[model samples]
Target: MADRRSAGSRSIAIVGPYLSGKTTLLESLLSVTGATTRKGSIKEHNTIGDASAEARDRQMTVEVNSATVEYEGLRWNFLDCPGSIELAQETYNALIGVDAVVVVCEPVVDRVLNLSPLFNFLDEWEIPHLIFLNKMDRADVDFMQVLHALAAVSSRPLIPHQYPIGHGHKLKGFIDLVTEDAFQYHSGACADPIPFPEELQVEEKSARQEMLETLADFDDKLLEELLEDIPPPQDEILQDLKMELGADLIVPVFFGVAEEDYGVRPLMEALLREAPDPSATAERRGLNDADNQPIAQVLKTYYTPQGGKLSLVRVWQGQIEDGMTLNDVRVGGMYRLMGQQHQSVLRAGAGELVALARMDQVKTGDVLTAHAPAPDLPVARMIPQVYAKAIEADNRKDEVKLTSVLGKLLEEDPGLRWEQQGDTHEIVLWGQGDIHLQVALSRLQRKYNLPMTTHQPKIPYRESIRRTTSVHGRYKHQTGGHGQFGDVFLDIQPRERGAGFQFTQKIVGGVVPKQYIPGVEAGVRDYLARGPMGFPVVDIAVTLTNGSYHSVDSSEQAFKQAARIAMQEGMPRCKPVLLEPILNIKIAVPNDFTSKILRLVSGRRGQILGYDAKAAWSGWDEVVAQLPQAEMHDLIVELRSLTLGVGSFEWTYDHLQEVPERFTTQVLQAAWNTK
Candidate 1:
C-alpha cells in the first residue's frame, strides 16, 4: 500500500489488562518483523513502550506507544496501548486515528474478565476489532471456556479464526483453522508451520470445520452452500471475513502466545487483507472532497524544549501546507512523531496522524475541520476522576516561585488543576489522584527545577446557621478629646442551605445615622467572611435594626466595630453547623470480588447503589456508589487489595450534605481557632 493510497493503512490497538503481555506482544511484533535489532525483555527493562523510569520499575505499560511495521509492502501501525484503566485515555487517544483494535486477552478466566472495558470501548466506538487470546502456555483452562467467557459480554459473534493445538501448560502453539495447518513456536519471534501431532489431528479437523461454518454465516452464498453440503472456497472465506469485519458485524478471535510470538504472522496477514483501510474509515466521518475544506483534530499535545507545544493531529480532509493559511489559521510548524521524539516533516495528509509544533491554544479535542464551517464532531471528553492537592514549599519567597512553576506545568496537563485557596494562603494543586498529582510535581522539579512540597488537600468545609437569634453589639472608647461610641441591634435568621450570606436593613426612625449604617453592614460582613469557625459563613440572614451612634466622635470604624461585635455575640447562639462534600464514584472489578467490595463500601460509610455487569471489564464487575470526599484517599488501595490488584475506579464531585455531629466537632473547632 502506497503512503498516498489515502485509505490509510489498517491499524490495530493491542490493549487489555495490566501484565497481560501488551508490551511483550509489542516487543514480539517489533522483533519478528525485524523492526528492532533485538527484542528487549521487560525483565531487562529495555522495551520500547515501557520506556519511562516509573513504567520500567513497575514492569507495565503506563502509556500507549505506537510502532510502525512494513509488512508485505503495506505499513501497519500497531498501537501498544496500556491495559490499566487508570491510563485508559492513552488507549482511547490511540484508538481515535486508527482503523481497528486487536484486544489481547489472557487464558485465565479471571484475567479474561478484565477485557470488558476494552470490549465496551471498541463496541461503543463501532471499531472493527479482533480478540487475541495470549499466554496459552501459562493456563490450565479449556479454550472453549475462554471463548464462551468472551462471548458472554460480546454482542457480535466472537468467531474464531484459530484454536490452540493443546490445552493449558502443555500448549505449544495454535492450529490455524482457516489454513488447516499447525503453527509451532520454533523461536520466540514467530510461528512456523509443522506436521500436526497425530493425537490432536482429529480435534484440529473439527475446529477447522467449525471455523469454516462460522465464516460461512457471514456470506449469503457461503451460508447457502454450507447448508447445501457444499465446501466454500478459500477466497470466499477470506472475502467473508473481510466483509464481516469491514461491516463491524463480527469480532474474529486469534489465539497466540505473544511472549513466544506463536501466531503473529497469521494475525498480521489477517490485518492487512481483512481490515478496512483509512479511506473507508474517513468516509464515515464525512471526509470525501479534496477541496471540501481542511478538517483535522488535535488528539494529544506535548511540549518541545525548543519549538514549544507539539499538537498531534489527524487530518480528515483537505491538505495542509507549509505556509498556506486555511481561513485565519496559520500553518504551524509540522513534525512527524517518531516514538516519543518528533522530526520536522514537509506535510502530512488527510487520514494521517502528524505532530505539528507549537500550537499553544489548541487542546486535546479541538477540531480544525473545514476552516470556514467547522464540521461538528462529537467531542472526545475524558473526566479526571481522582484528585489530590499539591502544595509548594510553604515558605514566604518560595510561594511566588511555586505559583510561577505551576503555571507552566499546567500547560502540559490540563487534567492538572490548582487553586490558591486565597485566604488560607495554601496553593492547592488538584489532579486525577496521588500519582497523577505527584507526576506533575515531579516534572516541575526535574524538568523545570522547581522544588516544592505537597500535602493531602484539606476539604473546603463551609459553616452556616440552623436557627436565628437577635443580639446587640456596642463599642465605646473615651480616651479624651473625641470619645468613641457606637451600638447595634440585629435580628439573625437561617437561610436555605446553599443560599449563602445575606444582610437586610430596617431602620424605622433612623436611630443611628443613615450614613453610618453602611459601615455597620461592612462590619457584620467582615465577621461572616471569616465566620465564628474559620471558614466562609453561609446560609445566614442578618437584619440591622435599632442602634446608637455619637454624633461627633462615632466614626464609620466605630459603627463597623459595633456591628462586628453584634455578629460575634449572635452567631454562636444560632446553632451553627458544618457542610462536607460528597463524591459519586464508580468502581469496576472482577465479578467474584463483588461481595467483598460491598463490604469494603460499608466500612467507609459509603452507600452502594448497585452492581451491574460491564462489558468493558475483563473478569470483573462494576459498582456505583456515593461516599464522602474526606474518606477517599485510601479507597483505591483498598479496591486493589480486595480485587487482588485487578479493580479500579473513577469519581467526581456529587453534592454537599451536612456533616455528621461526630465530624462537626473537628470542623467547628478548626474554624473557631482560625477565627
Candidate 2:
C-alpha cells in the first residue's frame, strides 16, 4: 500500500510560531507513519527535528531540519523550520521549494495574531497550506471561538475538517466532518472509528453543515445538491475538499494533541489525499518542462564538520544522479537527511528533497540545472537587519580563520552580515535580533571552534573647529653637512557645517616654492587624521598665506614639517566640537503603536522628520527620524517588544550633527579610553 502511494515523492514544510509544538508534532507524525518505533519528546531533548546541539542547548529550532519517511508506500519529506520570528527567514527559504506548508499553532485565541506575518507571506506567494491546531488538550477556549479567531487573521476561508468531541483541556476525540463518524484516539496508535455521541449530535451536524457550505462555494454541483436538500456522497465531499485545498480556496483546520499522537494519522491521510502533486506544484512555480535537463533549487545549506558542504535541494524536473554535473559543478553524493543523520541515495527523482554533498558553490535559493541554463526561480526577499554588534576573535592568531568561518556562516544564513567599518575599524555583525546573533556566535564556537567577543559598535564621530586663529610655523635643524630651515604662516578658519576640509595657498614673491606647496597640504591632512578631540577632523579650511624656505636645505619634507608645526600652533586656538553620526531610519509599525514608537525615538535623542502611512501597507505607519547610531544597537529590541514582534526598520547614514554640550565631556572621555 505504501509503495502504491510512493509512485512519486512530495515535500512539505512544517512552520509556526515559537513554542507552538511544531517539533513535537513532527515526532508524532513520524511515529504514526511507522518511520520510528517510538516518539521523542522535546523536554527529553530527544526529538528528531531539533537535532542540532545548539538547538538542544537552547531548546528551540535554530535551523531548517528535514526528515524523510515512507507511509503506506508513499515517500514524504517534511522540512521542519524554526519558529522564532528571528529565524523566520529559514522557514521562508524552505517554503519556496515545498509543495505545501503545515502551519502549526497553539489553540490560544490571542496568540493567533502571531501567525499574521506567516499567513501574509503564504497568501502573497499563493503557497498552499493548512492549519494544525496543536496542544488541543491544553486549550482553554471553545473550538468554535478558536476557529473564528484564526479566520480573522487569514485571508482565505477556514473550513473545519473535524469537530472536537470534548471541550477545553479534556479533549477526548474528534468527529470527522466529511465521513460523519466519530473517532477515539488510543494511547500510541491510530484513532479507532466509533459512533457519534447522541448528546453532541446537534453540534456535529452544525459543524458538518458549515464545512459543506464552505466547500460548496467552490463547487457548483455541491452547492446545488445542498440547496436541493440532497445529501452529498462521502466520496464527492472528499473530492471537493481535495480540489479546494489544492486550489488554495480554503484552509482546512484539523485539531490534535501532538504529544499524544492523536489526529496525526488523519492529517497524514489528508495530506496524501488533498495536497497537490509535485507536477502541479512545479507548474505553479513555472518549471513546466519536465523533459528538460535536471533542475533543482537550494532550500538550505549546511557546512558539516565531517561531510563538508551539503546543499539541501528540491528536485523540480528531470532526475539527479551521482556523477552528474550541475551548472559545471560535479555532484559528489546525494543523501536523504533524517535530522542530522543522513542516508546515502544513488539518485533523486523529480520532487525529492535531498542533500547534495560538496556543492560548495550552491547557496540557499540558488537554482541548479544542467549546462543548458537555469530558470529564474522565485526567491524570497531579504528582511532588513535591525540589530548589530562589533565582533572579533578572542585570539588574534585566528583572525583569518574567523573571516573564513564568517563567510560560511553567511552562506548558510544570509540574514547574518559582517563588514569592517572604514572609519571606526570595527567589524560589525548585523542580524535580525539579539538571539539571532547569539545563534551565529554559538555556531562559530561549536562548528568552527572559534571563540568570539562582541560589543556595541563604536560610532564614527567627527571633530570640527568652531573658531579660528593664525600663527607662524618654523622648522630648523642643524646637522653636520647643512642646516634645515623652513618657515610658514598659516591662516586657519572654520568652514560651514558639511563643507569639507579645503586647503589653499597665497604665498607669492618666491616666499614658498610651488613645488613644495603640495607637501603642506599633505601635512595638514595627516594632522586632521587625529584632532584635539581624538577624531578625524572635518569642516575646516587652512591657507598658507606666507612662508619662507631655503633653496638647498629646505625640501618638501622640511616644508611638510613646518606646515605641521603651523597647524599644531593654529588648531589649538580654534575651538573644536565633536560631531556624532546620525542615521536616517524609517520605522514601520502598526498605527496602534505609533505613539509608543514616537516616545521611544524622542527618548533616544532622535529628531522626528515626519510620518505617514507606509505605502501599500494598510494600518501601518512609517516613522522617519534621524537617530544617532549609538542608540540604534538596541532600538529593534524595544520596537519589537512594543509592537508585538511586528515592528521593523531600515536605515542609512544621514549626516553628522554636533553632540550636545552636556554629552561632550563623556563622549570625549570614552573616545580617549578606547584609544
Candidate 3:
C-alpha cells in the first residue's frame, strides 16, 4: 500500500456520462476508505453527492456536489459533477481546478461514444484522467471491445492497469498488471489475494506486456530492459505508471461494479500511487511560481434556501481564513460541504475546495485574492444556447420579483440567460436545450416560489417596402375656440437593405414650420415601428416634400397627427414584405454526421455556406450555414438525436431576409393575431 499521508491533500473530479454510476462510485469510495460507515445508494436517494432537494426529487444531479473525505491519513476533496450534457457547465468549471479526474463509464461499447465530448475536453486541457469501467457485473460485452471502442474517441492511449478474471455478472476477480497479484472480490469488504489462475495465464501475460509496452514509450530504460528479456521490478513499473499518468501521457484503466462496491479499494490504491500531486497540476497550469498570497478561483455558485449564496472555490495558493476579504468584499463564512449539509471551518489551505458565503459580488470563473490583485485564470467558456422560450410570470404581481429571481438563477448558471427583447417585448430565456430551460423554470417555481409560463420565443421580424408611393395628409378640426389645422405631403421610397429608416425634408418654401418639423419626424419614425405588415419597418426613406400649418392651432400634436395620417394611407400601397432573422451558425460534429447535418439545415430553409475541419478538433467538421431563427427552437433536440449528443453549434444573428412565400401566410397570421 502507498502512503498517501505524506502526499498531502488532493482534489479529484468524478465525471462521466449520465447514468454511469458516478455517484455510486463516490459512495463506494467513501465506504472503502472508511470515510463513511455505510455506503449510500442512488435508488435510496441517500447518496453523499447529489445532496440537494432538487436533485433528490428529480433523481438527477443538476449542479456540482462537493464533499471531503479522509483516507489513509490523507485528505481528499471529491467534486462529483453532473453528467447530463445540459448541466455540463458545472463539470467544465470544476474540472479546471482539480488535480485529476476519474472518468466513470459503463462497459457498453456503443455507450462509449458518449464520452467523446468529455474526452475532447480532457485532451484539450491535457488533464490527467483515468477511466473506471463501472457496472462490470451488468456488462455483457467483451471487455477488450469496450476498450477498443473507447480508444476511437480518445486521443490518449488506453493502458489497462487491471484485467478481469471472469466475464459478465459472474465476474469474480482481477489480475493487477503491475503487482502481478490476483485478487478475488468479496462484497462489502476488501478483495482477497488469490493465486494466479492457471486458465488465464496467456491472457494475463499479454495484458501485462501491453501495459508495460505503453509505459515503456516514455522510459527508455524500461524499453531497453524489455527488449533484453529482463523483467522490470514491481517498484519500477509503478513508478513509470505514476510518472506517465501525472504527465497525461496515458490513461490508466480500471474496472468495477460501483453499485456492489467491488473493485473500489484497488481503484483507490491506484489513485494514491498514480494521481498527480497539486504542485504537478499547478505547474501544468503555469501557476507553479504564483505569489504566496491567498488566491482562489470560484468553480461553481450555489443559492441554497438555508445559506443564501455559496461560492464553491478552490484555493490555488496560500491560506484563506474566515472573515478574510477577497475581491474587496468580506467573506461571510467558510464551510466544507457534505452533500447538502455543510460544516463550518476556521480556515482552508491551498488545494482545498470550500464554499465562501456571501461573496455575492464574485461569479463563476472569477479569481479572488487577499490584498494582492487577482490572477487571470483560464476557465471554460459557456456553450452556445440552442433552445429558447418566452417566459412570463403566472401571477401578474410577481413580475417585479421575476427579474431578481432570474438574475440569481443566471448567477448560479452562466449557461442560463434571460433577455428582454425590445422588438418582441418578451422575456426570453435561453439554454442548451429544452430540458435545460425546463429545469431552470422548475427551479424558479420551486426555489423562488415564482411560477412562470413559457412558450416558444417569437422571431424578431422586420417589414420593408417593395415599391414607392406618395400620399397627402391633412388634420383639420373645428372646435369651440381655436381651430386646429395641419397638412403635409410625404414621399416614401424603398432604400437598400440595412439602410435603416432615414428622414429628410425637401421643403423649398416655408410650407411646414421648422418647429413642427421635429414632431413630423417623430410621428414618421414611430409609425414605421409597426407598418402594414404588422412588424417593425426598416430600410425606407421618408421625405417631407410639402406641408402647411396654422400659427395658433397647428402645434407639434397636429403636425404629428398629419404625418401619422400620411403613413397609414401610403404604407398600405407600398407593397410591404416580411423579413425574418437569419443566424450564422457553425455546427460541429464527427465527419460521419456531416451529411446528416447538412440535410437537417437544408430542410429548415438554411443555406449552407461551406464546411471545413474544425480547428484543434480531430475527426470533427464544422458546417457553416445560415438558418432562420424560427427553425432553431427545436434544432438542438433533433441534432442531439441524430448525433448521439456529441453534436453542438454556435450561432449569431447574420441578417434579415425575405420570408419564403410558402411560410409568409403563417408568419403573418401569427404576427397579426399576437398584436
Candidate 4:
C-alpha cells in the first residue's frame, strides 16, 4: 500500500522451541538478502547460524549467533538464538536489545503449548513480536485451529496478516489480507502474483474480515468503518497493522515453509514495513538521544582461539568508534559478525550489533558508555540452575588451567554457574539441565584443551549420634628423660536437629590444667571432621568431665592426643546415622501436567508438602515438596519431559534428614566406591 522505507538500523531476534526451524528461518533470510553466496543446511552441518563446533556436533543451536544484512536500503541485524529450553538464557539475554522478535514455530497444535514461556516473557517486557508459522508444507491440522491454540497461550490478540492457500503437506502460497492479493511460491525465488482462487473466496473473505475486526479494536476510525459496513482503504489498514504491531498490542501471524524459502521474502517485506525504527526502540527503552554519549549493552561474550575476548553488544544510543574508552577499558577493536566470521568496522551507530574486542572489564548484561560511569540498563535475569555435576580436570596438572578457563566459560554463558562446595569439598558446576552442562564441558575441551571428568555432585551427607556414652582415655609414654603423660574422660551426646556442634568441659581443682583444656576441644573438632560414617559430624555435643595430668610432662599436645583417643574409642559406641541434605522445592508446571509431576516426586522418595496455583500464572500450578538432594540430580530432566520442556523449579536447603535404613548401605557403599 505504501512504498515507505524506514531509516537507520533495526535489530530482531529469532526465537522459539527447539526444532521449530528458527535457524532455518535465519538461513533463508540471509540467503534471500544476498549476504551469503549460498544457503547452508542443518543436516549438511554447514549452516551459518549453528556454526560453533559444539552446536554442529549436537545439530542444535547452543548460543546466540549474530548476522548482519542490508535490504531495501535498511540495515538489519538478526540474532539467531538457541531454541532448547535449557539454553533459553541465551535467547532472553539477546532479546533485551532487539527492536522486534520473530517467533518461529511449527503448525502442530499439540506442540503449540511450547510457545507459552516465550510469549510470557515478551508480554512482560512489552517487546513487540510476530509469529512465523514455519513448516506449513508438513501441516496436518487446520490453520485456524493452530491459530486459536496460539491465541490461548498469548496475552495479546492474534491477527492473521496472511492466510495460507494450500492443502496439507503442500503449501502453494498465501493471500495478503490487507491487500487481498494472491501469490504463488517458487523455489529459491520470490513469489509470483496470481489470480484469486474462486474455490477459497469465502474463507479468504472471512479471514480478512476477522483481521480487520481485531485491528479495529485499537483504532476508532477503523472501528467506525467496520461498524458501518464500509470497507477500510488499503493504506489505512496497513497503517493500523504497523502501529498496532509496533506498539506490541497485537501479534500478526504469517505462514510459510522456511526450508523451501516460500514465505521468506514476504516475511522480510512485512518486517521492513511493520517493524519500528531504532529511534522508536530507544524511546521505548527510555534512552535519551540528545546526550551525545555512546551507550551500549553486552548481549553475549566470546573467547577466541587466539586468546582474544570479544563482547557482542548493541549500540543503543550513540556511535561507538574503534579504540574508544568505556568503563575505564579501551575498546581494542570493533567488528560486525556473520556467524563466527568478523568484518572490521571503524564505527557503529545506534541499533547496530557489533563485537568489541578485548573489553576485559566488561561482562554480559553490563551497560557501557564512553563516559566514566555507565548507566544501568535492565537485563534478563538468569534462570535458576536445575542440574549440577562435580567436575575436575582429567589431568591433575591441568587443575589450575581448568579453573582459569572456567571463568571464561561462565563469562561467555551466564546461565552456567560453578562453585567450590565447602561441605562436599568438590568443584561443582550447575546449569539449566544435563545438555546445557554437556555443551559447557565440550567447550572446555574444544576451546581450551582442558578435558574434564564429571560426576553427580556429592549429597553433602553428614553424621549424627543417636545415643550418649562416656569413655575414658589415658596416654602415658616414658622415654628415658621427659615423658608424655595425660588423661581425659569425654561424654558425647546428640543435640536437636540443626543445633550444630557444641563443646564444653567440667573439671575438678587442678585435675586438667586450664592451658591444656583447649587442646581437648581442638582434638574433638578434628575427629568430627570425619566421623564413624565417613562424613562430617553435626548436631552433637562433647564434654570433658574429669581427667588427671602429670604436672611435669603434661602439655596441650599430650592432652590433644588423649582427647582424640577418647573420641576414637567412644564414637563407634554412639550409633551414628547418615543424614542426607533435603531440599525444599517449588515446581512450576502447567495444570494439565500437575498430576504427572506429583507422581514423579513420589517416585523419587520426595514428600509432597502441598501444591497451589502459581501466583499470577494462569493455567499453571506450583507444587511444594521436600526431596533429598540425591534425588534432585535428574529431576529437571524428567520434569521437562513430562511438561513439554516448559516446567521448572527453584529449591533451597530445607534440612538434614536421616537416610532410610534400606538405602543407607547403598549410599555408604557408593561414597566408599568413589573414594
lDDT of 3 at 433: 83
Tens-digit per-residue lDDT, 281-385, candidate 1: 677555676564767777666654566777667776666665545435566777655356555667656556676665656666677753566666654456454
lDDT of 4 at 144: 92
Show model 4 residue runs off by greater than 4 Å. Answer: 1-6
> Which lDDT tens digits does candidate 2 get at residues 593-655?
899999999999998999999874556799999999878889999998998887889899888
On lDDT, the candidate that comes out on top is 4
The residue-by-residue lDDT of candidate 3 on 1-675, one tens digit each, is 355665567899999988998899999988888878989988888899877666777777778888898876677899899888888887899999998999999999878878888988998898999999998887485888898998888989999989898989789989998888899998888889999999988988998999888888999999999999999999999898889888888999999888778888888998887888876786677675466788889999999998999999988878899998999999999999888889999998878899999998999999999875677879997887778989999999999888889899998888888899999889999898876787788889989998898888888889899999999998888799988787999999999988888999998778888888998998898898898878899999999999888878898888888899999999999999999989999999889889999999999999999999988777889999999988998998898889888789999997889998889999988877877
Pairwise TM-score winner, candidates 1 and 2 = 2
Candidate 4 residue lDDT tens string, 31-72: 999998789999999898999999999889999999998877
Model 4 clash pairs?
Answer: none
Query: Comparing candidate 1 with candidate 3, which one achieves the higher lDDT?
Result: 3
* Model 4 / residue 505 / CA error / Å: 1.7
Compute the lDDT of residue 469 as modeled in candidate 2. Answer: 92
lDDT for 367 (candidate 1): 79
* Candidate 1 Cα deviation (angstroms), residue 238: 1.4
Candidate 3 regions with alpha-carbon error over 4 angstroms? 1-3, 289-291
Assess every candidate by TM-score. 0.88, 0.95, 0.98, 0.97
RMSD of each: 3.6, 2.3, 1.5, 1.7
**How many Å off is the CA of 597 in candidate 1?**
5.0
Ranking by lDDT: 4, 3, 2, 1
